[model samples]
Target: MDTASLKKEIIAYSKTIGIDKIGFASPSTFEEMKVRLYRQQELRYQSGFEEKDIEKRTEPSLIFDKPKSIISIALAYPSKMGPKVISKKGERRGIFSRASWGTDYHTVLRDRLKKLEEYIALKMPEARFKSMVDTGELVDRAVAERAGIGWSGKNCSIITPEFGSYVYLGEMITNIPFEPDHPMEDRCGSCNKCVDVCPTGALVQGGQLNAQKCIAFVTQTKGFLAEEFREKLGNRLYGCDTCQTVCPENKGKDFHFHTEMEPNPEIAKPLLKPLLSISNREFKEKFGHVSGSWRGKKPIQRNAIIALAHYRDETAIPELITVMKDDPRPVLRGTAAWALGKIGGQDALEALQHAFSVEKDEEVLQEIRKGLYFFAEKKQG
Candidate 1:
């Protein structure tokens, strides 16, 4: 059978195995992406989590031997939860972004890619294939754009007409010389909503991001969040979706095709107070399966403290004091001290004063001073 016929069969089989969209591209070097990546590096705008080797990221031939074509796949995820966990006065909940809604996309997309590989192997026994999800050296969005799966959105996401920007992307590099799909035309003309609504001005322009200022990146860091970004974080525990949510193309684009991708409201948006004292074992039992939990409980817990402060939830003051006093991690202790000041009252003031006297870490001491300053400002007001 010719490669064209096999490509058609693969596309058909993909839908059967829960793959929503698939496109093929020439496995040539991503010349344009290489330039942008170098510029991003020069500006120091890259998130540290990304693959550092730009050559491996842009050159498919470096990672895959004898690469002839690349196949890009996308699976749409739900934008809204089914049963919402409402955030009220005392029971305020912190949210994980829609990307971290259900089971990890890495696991789900890899499963689909594995099935596709096995099917292709049966058809062409000599076909060689290498597959990868988000963490792979090859940039998934660039490949998806090249393969006509979607146009790269202003928000730096691949925006498929069918699923908008709420899609998980994966790719497979193969030795089979398949006809590549036509690339999609840019549809984000004259739209700057994503940039305008970015909480931290992280969207430097249409397609570029300063990852250091991005709340999505900030929430993943295991340190005291910069004072300026804490309030911007709002109630987000894992990732920020402001850019995607504000994009006009993503409006009303919610798809729940895979059951495994469906979110449990309680887990995706859990009460913030319970998280303050959750043991490592309990956190794993509850959030272990989700992609947001990949960085462990520290970032989440720290963000939850910031969220409580954002709400000015006086009820959480007791919990924040406990975290400040007893939590071993200085980031959490320092953040909780700052939060206590943000949620000022007699209790919070006393706690901050006590922490100031007892806290040994200079960073924690600095936070206690910041907390005390809030009270002084309030008194002058």
Candidate 2:
């Protein structure tokens, strides 16, 4: 079997199955990445979501037996929503980042990888393969960079020449000796736009991120948002796209190649007040198909309350009061209390004062105090 011919066939087959870009890489130990992983660990900069084993993450051989090459694939998602849902006064909305605009990308990428695997298996019956999306042990960006998919951008995303940094990456490890593609040059050069625009200053430096400070990571946390980052969240409900949106490389880079990748404006940018009262079943029914819903409604709802605060929407005050007074989750209740304080008015202050007197939870009481402080500040001013 001619390995070179087989690689060419796989590339051609990939295009037919909706893979936007494909590249092959040698399955060598990612020595440089291993160093960075250790540094991230030492600095406590890692998001708890990543696979814990650094060896498995960097050494393909540790996860897949006799791996000869890694096939990196990228699928571009839309940067712009088709029919914009205007977030006007009295009807403010929260936004999921562009990455969560469509059907869960994990499902889309996994389907594409499975098809590629099936095609390769049929051609070479003995080829052993292992594949993974974002949740997998292998770092998708590192694999893509090595496979010539793109360069690792300043914002810690794979910036493909064709799709900028708005691409979803997946990889397959196999015992096939395909010729490796060369990695792309660091086109980011002196551009620090992504770092400059990161709301939380999550981009510690070029190609490095302190995930704890990233609004994208913070939005997914199922807890009371820290007071410092609350205002920075703006109306983002799930992830933060400030870094990508500010990237000059991503300028004019929007693609609608796959129907599944399209955003439903209503779901992607839904009314914030409606989100405050949404039932579990209602939340699941509407947002379950999107990747942003994976953390479930708790984080999204918490962020929604903060978004309401960001807009200082007087109309959402009633819903925020209800959440503050009756929500089962302490995080939501506390977040609602804070939102009430931020969206201060006579009614909002009255509700916070009432909650402070009756709320049993210690954390909730503290939030209620924080809420009342806004009124105190207003009086002093």
lDDT of 1: 0.95
Q: What number of backbone clashes does candidate 2 have, counting pairs of residues 3 or more apart or in separate chains?
A: 0
Encode model 1's per-residue lDDT on 187-255: one tens digit a residue.
999999999999999999999999989999999999888888997999999999999999889889999
Model 1 C-alpha RMSD to native: 0.6
Spell out the clash pairs found in candidate 1.
Answer: none
lDDT of 2 by residue, 1-381 (tens): 789999999999999999999999999999999999999999999999999999999999999889999999999999988887798999998899988987999999999999999999999999999999999999999999999999999999999999999999999999999999999999999999999888888899998999999998999899888888997888899998888998999999999999998999999999988888899999999999999999999999999889889988999899999999999889999989988898899899889988988989999898988889888988899
Worst 10 residues of 2 by lDDT: 223-232
Task: List candidate 1 stretches off by more than 4 Å.
Answer: none
